[model samples]
Target: MLLIEALTTGGAQRQLLNLAVQLGGRGHRVSVVVYHLADYNHRDHFRGEFERAGVPVTDVPVMAPWRRLWAVRRTVRAAGPDVVIAFLRRPGLLAELTALPARRFALIVSERTGKEGGRDMKDLTRFQLHRLADAVVANSAHLEHYVRTAAPWLRTRLRQITNSVDLDHFRPAGAPPPPHPGLRILAIGRFRPEKNFLALAAALRILRTTEPALDVTVDWYGNNFFLGQQPTGRSRPYLELLDVLRETGLEDAFRVHPPVGDVVALYQKADVLCLPSRYESLPNVVCEALACGLPVLASAVSDNDRLVRDGENGFLFDPHEPRSIAEAIRRFAALSADERAAMGRTGRRLAEELLSPATAAVRWADLVEQVVEARRAAW
Candidate 1:
């Protein structure tokens, strides 16, 4: 059983869906239990895909917190899965609680973010509950270190499993898009403060003032709101970014787009992929961009150092400093066309070596089997 908050369009949710599909293909009995169903804009986003892949999805009806817990426990009991893998904090906590009474099954909880991402109280509670899990999965080495440092008790159970990219689908185009009049920059992710879209706008403003002759246009893709888990209705972050653009006279140089299904196409059309996030566990956008042979300019946070070799495949900068971002952009913009292409090729090689979906799935399967067999032996 694979448990998660929802099948939203976020990186973690998408990775969960991919793992479920791959696990099922490996001849394992797989099913997904979604905690909240209606909270997402594209509620049916991965439902049909799961169904077609022979994975049943159970939606736990919404109710009070206690009732929801009861419902999830009941659903798990009905499924009678040998092992339960839960993603995100809430699902991990619920899985720990659910596995207590039914100790026959193994429980694996995934921590997708750094310890600093959540409130102290919530992190403490999660750390306590994680002690009961058979194992804990961290998406990046940075996250694993964060968890171990915060709760030393998790040292034995914790394992780092980096997020995977569908290399076959995100492969580089036969040739780069024909050079255009201006540089085309692409940024994709949820519209949240941590993403620092406003900072990107600020950097662009600095670029316009310092290098007025440089022609660059940025296309930002992502939704203003997120569903499931942290259901947000606040459009203020996105609106503030728009306000910044207007104030900086960058309104004409930027465009905002909602999240799209064909993100590979966006990568193909873009000259460079920029991620100005304050922090991340293991950003899937970076993995996908590398797979698509696009050079990156991202914040030097989390596992970005592992993904990007400075001055090799891409450049990393201090996200807090708009001037640093502007400097990185200047560096990228100054590269010759052949130099840029070489950098992109390096990125693609890194993706193939580190972010292969097949490799990640095999690791997931091995961990699941290891835990399940250990539980059976103990029983």
Candidate 2:
């Protein structure tokens, strides 16, 4: 059984969906247990894909907190899965509570983010739950470090499994498309403050003033909404970004689009992929862009250093400093067409070596089998 908050389009959600499908394809009896389906509409939700892959999906849509726990507990007891793997915080907490006694089945909880503060109590709760889980998985070396430092008692149970991308689906284009009038840059992710979309807009404004002759355009792709968070009366982050673009008079240069399912097509059209995030465990967009042979310019945060080799496949900037981002963009713009293509090819090689979905699935299955055997040995 794989448990998560919901089947939204975030990186963690997509990764969980892919892993569930992959594990099911590997002859495992897999089912997904979601807390609610409030964030996504039917058109964009991944429930259909789960069904198509012969994986059952149980939607435990209870709104009340304790009721949600009871619902998940009931579902888990009925499913009687050999192993229950939960993604993110809420699911991890519920899975830990539901799989008490730890003797009946193995429990593994995966943490996707490395950010800290503003949730000390929540983090402490997750740490307490981590003590109950058979294993706690972190998706990057950076995230693993965060987990260990945050809850040193769980060091024995810690496991690292980097996020993966579908190489076959996100591969490079057959031939580079004809050059557009300007450089096409792409940024994809949620509109959270940590993602720093406003910083990207600020950087575009700087570039517009500094490099007047440079022809460059940025296409920002993502939705404004986030799950499980109350909306402030103030404008959302996406709207804030739009306001920044207008104030900087760079509206024409930066365009925002809602999140789309066909993201590979956007990658195919882009000359470079930029991630101006304040922090991340490891972004799926970076991996997908690299797989599609698109050079990247990401912030110097988390495990980005592991994926992007500076001056080779991609460049890193201080996400807080709009000037740094603008400078990196200028450098990428200066590269000749052939030079840019070479950099993209290097990124593709890195993706093949590090972010293949097959490799990730193998790692996950190995961990699952290890935990189950360890539990049986104890018995």
Candidate 3:
């Protein structure tokens, strides 16, 4: 059984959905359990896909903290899975709880990211709960380091599977369309502080004043799901970003669009892909762009160093500084057409090497088998 908060559209959500589908295709019986009670209807964006893949999905939509645990317990007992793997924080904690004396399944909890306040008691407590897990999976080396630092005992069970992109879905298209006035830059992700669109707006302001002759445009494809759907009187992160764009007087240059199901077309349309995120384990958008043969300009964080080789395939910038973001764009713009195309080819090669979905699923399956066997041996 694969457990997650909800099937909402985000990097982590999308990655888990892909993995679930891939694992099902590999002749494994997989089930998804969603327990996010608030706005359950709005968050099940992938229900149709799960149904199409013939993977059963069960919802444990209960609001009360104790009731939610009982709901997850019932769903897990019904699934009768040999292994119960949960993704993200809350689900991880629940998976650990489900491993009480009566439970027979081996538990594996996957962590996709880490944040500031490494010494925070809340984060440390979560890491300590991994002692109940048969194995702890982290998508990036940085996250693995994070848990190891928080709880050294996790070293023996820690596993790194990395993030993956479906190459067949995100392949190179014909020569990219020419820009109308100048270059076309693309950014894709949810609107949040960590995505750093506000800093991107600041960089656009820098470009607007410093490089007046450079008539470049930015297209941000997103659903503004960072804070999720807004409620009455709540501060909307998406709206706040728009306000920042207007304040910087670059609203015309930076355009935001609704998220698309087929994002490969968006990649095909853009000259360069820019990700100015303050935090990421391994951003799915970057891998998609690379697979689509789009040159990249990404933040230098986490495992981005492995995915994007500076100057060879794409440029990396300090996401904190708007000046650094603008400077990287300038560097990318200075490259000749042939140089840029060569960079795209290098990115495509990197995608093939680093982000194969089948390979990732196989690695995950291998870990599941290892953990299950270890548990059986102990029994």
Candidate 4:
């Protein structure tokens, strides 16, 4: 099997790594092809992890859009694998296009984001590339719905498999931290505008003022660099929020940490996990935090409503409203120890049932087998 993706880190990278290791151990040859060769933050860590797992990994240089086609064709043909599995829209589209002549091998496309719509030309290309794939995989049911709309013919070919984390590694079972004086607010993800870290900072500032007695410290563990190669128009919202934080003079209150492999340690120390994203299909941090027995406060978007039961495991707030976020933080901070523990337990139960690595691998394995069988029958 060949797994193709751009960069590493984020939920998508971790899922791919887990799948490669699991599938490779079962007598299946697995190879990973990353498009970037530069030693950025995520790539550095991922290179080590992939090497440790004994998976054959390659990094090729292809910066431009058109150049990617040649890169895709060259890599897939060179690997000559039984199947090619790709994550993210661009790499998936490339896999489908390049695997056209290699009809004996099945091409699988995985969607990690929501319907990005016309904002990106790649969305249109993905729509056109759908028919070339043996199957389309969506991490959430909400994303599957969007996929179906993009390519109606692929509706019968679409399947849902939520992203997974290593349960044992991410569990509440970790070394305890020394008791801290303040309420430690933790957030994790890539340092992209989509993450809306600025909004989180603004909300923390507001909460500090409104609830002065609450000693609060916000710690962010996100991607070491800013979002993408270039900024999108949607970036303005995040920039505005950052300006608010700087103007209000709260830079010292909230600190951003470089990405680390042992996120479980941060989750264990955190009082609450905040996922204030402008957009998200499904976030792995919230799931990881829940598995670590930390309550979550996330924006109600896409699968968030399905994952988080308001006032149960955690509360959902409007991403556009800083005041709403502040209030939710206040509510979480005010909860009794028992109440908070109950919320954490509820989150863990949900994660065990829905987001375990074993569960995800089984689902994906079944889907890949089915797609391969269907392709054989079609021939």
Candidate 3 residue runs with Cα over 4 Å from true position: 40-42, 225-235
Cα lDDT tens digits, model 4, 1-379, are: 6555554678888778888876776667788887752334455556777888998787767467677678867877877666788988767877877876657778888888863333356665676677788888888877777777766777877888887877788887454466567778898877667777777777877877788888777887765543445434433544564566688877677776668876777888787888988778878788788788788999978898877888899999988888888888888888877787789889888888888777777777777777777767777
TM-score of each: 0.93, 0.93, 0.93, 0.89
Between 1 and 4, whose lDDT is larger? 1
Ranking by lDDT: 1, 2, 3, 4
In model 1, residue pairs whose N, Cα or C atoms come closer than 3 Å (at least 3 residues apart or on different chains), thus clashing, are: none
**10 residues in a row with least lDDT, candidate 2:** 226-235
- Local distance difference test, candidate 2: 0.85
TM-score between candidate 1 and the true structure: 0.93
Model 2, residue 206: C-alpha shift (Å) = 0.9
Best candidate according to lDDT = 1
In model 1, state the lDDT of residue 219: 94
Model 2, which residues run further than 4 Å from truth?
A: 37-44, 101-103, 116-121, 226-235, 377-379
* Residue-wise C-alpha lDDT for candidate 2, range 20-121, written one tens digit per residue: 867876788888888872443322466666777787888887478888888899889888888999998878888989876544788999889868344387
Off by over 4 Å in 1: 37-40, 115-119, 226-232
| Root mean square deviation (Cα) for candidate 2 | 2.8
User: Backbone clash tally for model 4?
Assistant: 0
Q: Please write out the lDDT profile of model 1 over residues 1-379, one tens digit for every residue.
A: 9999777667887788789877887899898999873354554555766777788888887678989988999999888889999998889888999987658888999989653354487787889889889999999998898889889989999988899988888989987788788789999987878898888888988998999899989999886764543445566787788787777788888889877866899998899999999988899899999999999999999999999999999899999999999999999999999998999999999999999888889999999999999999989
lDDT of 4: 0.76
